[model samples]
Target: MVGLEMNELKKIGLGLTGFGVFFLFFGVIFFFDKGLLAVGNILFVSGVMTTIGVQSSLQFFTKRGNFKGTVSFGIGFFLVIIGWPVIGMAAEAYGFIILCSGFWSTISVFMQKIPVIGWLFQRFGLNQP
Candidate 1:
């Protein structure tokens, strides 16, 4: 069980690291191409910070719970949304996740269930029975 968990962690770590490095490199390229520095920098930093957050999520939140991870992920996601267009594909990808999370988190509070929206919330496990 321990070995299995370690393997899963290693896989997750590699995935997050790869994702972060991809954005970092892309941001650097954008900078060289005279693209928006603010967007590039935001993407670069958010990628790095998000990756670190995910990699350390387990150990960092083992005792504290996943609230911190959720917040960091949320912030990273918000940056991605704001950085898109001026930033590139990396931002869009992360932004989509943030948008989805936002919908999930907020949809449950809605008194009236809108078609499809409520279904999405439940499907994503944000709306409890």
Candidate 2:
């Protein structure tokens, strides 16, 4: 019933997310080509965010998972590396956003919970709220 529907939605989200990642990978493989790499990377990230956002929202409605925004908040880090010489500053800007907001913060949160991780966070002052 409701569970089945939720599962289906989750599947759809995961599928889209996979495609988005594949698109990014494709961009990486063809790094020499500026046009394809830039366009493809942007599209892939956008698609992933959209699908995940939808899934997260649905889960939130059902009181299952909290709705984190679709934007991977920190993907810009990898994007910056991809962008630099290839796509230029614009892409790098996006990369920074992804890095500072999405990935780094999330990992930092998890790190604060583990003993060793917490120590590391304290050492680096990365656990500040």
Candidate 3:
């Protein structure tokens, strides 16, 4: 459906923005940093990109009743979670995701309640509920 595609695009945008934050989260190492951590950064970046890509792709391809998005989201989440340990930076990354995801999701949900702003979305012709 067109609506599903749009929603998926939004999610993909969110996920990519989230990955950009992850880069900010872990990209500040000194030149002296070494070993498994360096290795982990590769996986971390890939995981983030992959998740965003899958979500966007699912939007383009998935049907209403299919579980592909759910499965892709789960796998993307798992890849991100597991990639940290492999890179030896699990604690920092994990904490960052929890804080960011929780706070953002909550704020967005709350903002969806305001009148004019919420109504503006309806004005644009997209279903809000």
Candidate 4:
């Protein structure tokens, strides 16, 4: 997204930024053996990041002029959340996040091929799409 449109980039940036934090936070949570208090902290942080990620992904879907991706993102996002306690493996729970996080990174690195959308995903590490 180096020389791409700012508006579109922003959407992708938001998703990448939010998803990055989400993964970092979730990974730490899993990497550690904490008590309920720690779980509470993860819950709080995840809640905030989830909201931000959703908003960003929504923008990308909307800007790309695709409602299906937006809807899928929403469903996938919620599934990631709802399936948490039921899942035995923390990695499995966290894997849901990787979908968006990995996708954001992948799209960023390949921005040239996908055009506007790719540029937006790449904006995550750069802090701007």
Better of 1 and 2 by lDDT: 2
Write model 4 residue lDDT over 1-129, tens digit each, in one string. 543445554565556556555554664566532332234334443444454455654465565444444455445344345543323234434444543553775655566467776565556555354
Each model's lDDT: 0.50, 0.53, 0.48, 0.47
Candidate 1 lDDT by residue in tens digits, 1-129: 543344544655556556555655665576523234334445544444454555454554342444444455445445545554334444444544543453654556682377787677667876664
Off by over 4 Å in 2: 1-6, 32-85, 92-107, 111-125
Return the number of clashes found in candidate 1: 0
C-alpha TM-score for every candidate? 0.28, 0.39, 0.24, 0.28
Among these predictions, the greatest lDDT belongs to 2
Residue 90's C-alpha lDDT in candidate 3?
A: 45
The sequence of per-residue lDDT tens digits that candidate 2 reaches over residues 1-129 is 644454554666566656655655665676634544456455555554455565654453334221222232233334444645344434544533544453677777787889987998899988777
Model 2, C-alpha of 95: deviation from truth (Å): 7.2
Pairs in steric clash, model 2: 73-98, 73-102, 74-98, 74-99, 74-102, 75-98, 76-95, 76-98, 77-95
Clashes of each: 0, 9, 1, 1
Q: In angstroms, how far off is 50's CA in candidate 1?
A: 12
Model 1, which residues run further than 4 Å from truth?
Answer: 1-9, 32-77, 84-129
Model 4 CA lDDT for position 38 = 38
